[model samples]
Target: MGHWLDRNIVEPGKLPLLLALAAFVLTFLVTRVITRLIRAGRGPFGNIRPGGLHVHHVVPGIVLMVIGGFGSVAVRGHGPGAVVAAVLFGCGAGLVLDEFALVLHLDDVYWTEQGRKSVEIVVLTAALVGLVLAGFAPFGVNELTPDELQSRSIVVTNTLINFLVALFALAKGKPRIALIGAVVPLVALVGAVRLARPGSPWARRFYRHRPRARRKARVRAYRHDARWAAVRNRLHDLVAGAPDR
Candidate 1:
């Protein structure tokens, strides 16, 4: 176990990444708790307004992200500098993503149903980053042996194949599958072969001419969504507070 950690994480200089992931997730959770308190009118927190203009958290988030990103690039990947940059970036990301729906809709919808999107996205981002910190590599290339990695042709071929499979999964309207496929190609292949989302580009182009298949796909989607909607909503509320309406 020690050797595995040493080879996969320490040697690859991924400690900063793990730290960033932790900070990102923790920041998001803390931010949500504060916001939830504010929404309930129970906290010392209040809305920030200057000159009758509301100041959103995303502004500071953007600044931090820029500084951290540029600073990291300017400094070496290892050591204290990298760690600091990663922490800053993660903090900024949590702030920005917590208000993602506000940016997307160009409105103050923090307690509305639209705000749930921010929670969903934040959860997804945290999950993906957590996976990375667990030693999964992007594009399934980490599975290559030293000999295969040393061969330019083999590495290139493997990467191209994984990229294509991921793309195919995306084209099928399976974003979650495609994302996982970037780390595990087998998942992508399965997603690519499955039925496309009824509203996806793939279904619009391919299922348009196949009525029975489209109907079945639609039914399946509806059932799945119905089954998970309650659980999803509870999770969103638990993390970001219940919607205003």
Candidate 2:
């Protein structure tokens, strides 16, 4: 175990990244627990307010992010300073993302259905970062041969192709797939070739002239949502607590 840790983490200079990921996840979970407890009125914790203005946690999060981001840039090597900076940045990111919906909508929507977006974004962010920690390079660069990696044109071409595919997936309303596809091109290819979701930009523009395509897209979207929406919601509730009715 120690050998694997040294080879995969320490030797590769990934200790800070690992520490950051751990800090991010732990901060998010702890924040959620505290927030949930406050919501249920079962804890000593309560919302922060000053001068009749509700102070959101994201404020402190932003400050921490700025400090840590600069500190990480200023500090060299994977030393104590780097590790501390990484942890601070991770914690700040967790706090900011926890209130992503509020930032996105410019309103307090933390306990509303719209707030689920925050949870989803946080989960996606964690997954993407975790994939990076697991050595999955963006645009599938890790899959290329040493010779291919050495060729700038070849690397650029490969990245361009994968990026376009991921962009296509995003246009098809498969943001999650597109994001994952950035690291795994095959997933983006699948999403790109699949029918666009109903009401998505791609579907609205391209399927408008094709009645059959529109119908099929709607049907597929409905079926897909019916199949997975409950499971997704349950997972969200389990992680972030149910939103206000």
TM-score of 2: 0.98
lDDT of 1 by residue, 1-245 (tens): 88987887789898778778878888889988988777779969987889988888889888888988887898877689999999999989999999999999999888899998888788778877877777667877788998898999998899999999889889888887888788878999999888887888889999988999899889988998899989999988776789987
TM-score of 1: 0.92
What are the Cα lDDT values of the candidates?
0.86, 0.93
Where does candidate 1 clash, by residue pair?
Answer: 139-182
* Top candidate when judged by TM-score against the true structure: 2
> What would you estimate as the lDDT of candidate 2?
0.93
Residue range with the least summed lDDT across 10 consecutive positions in model 1? 130-139
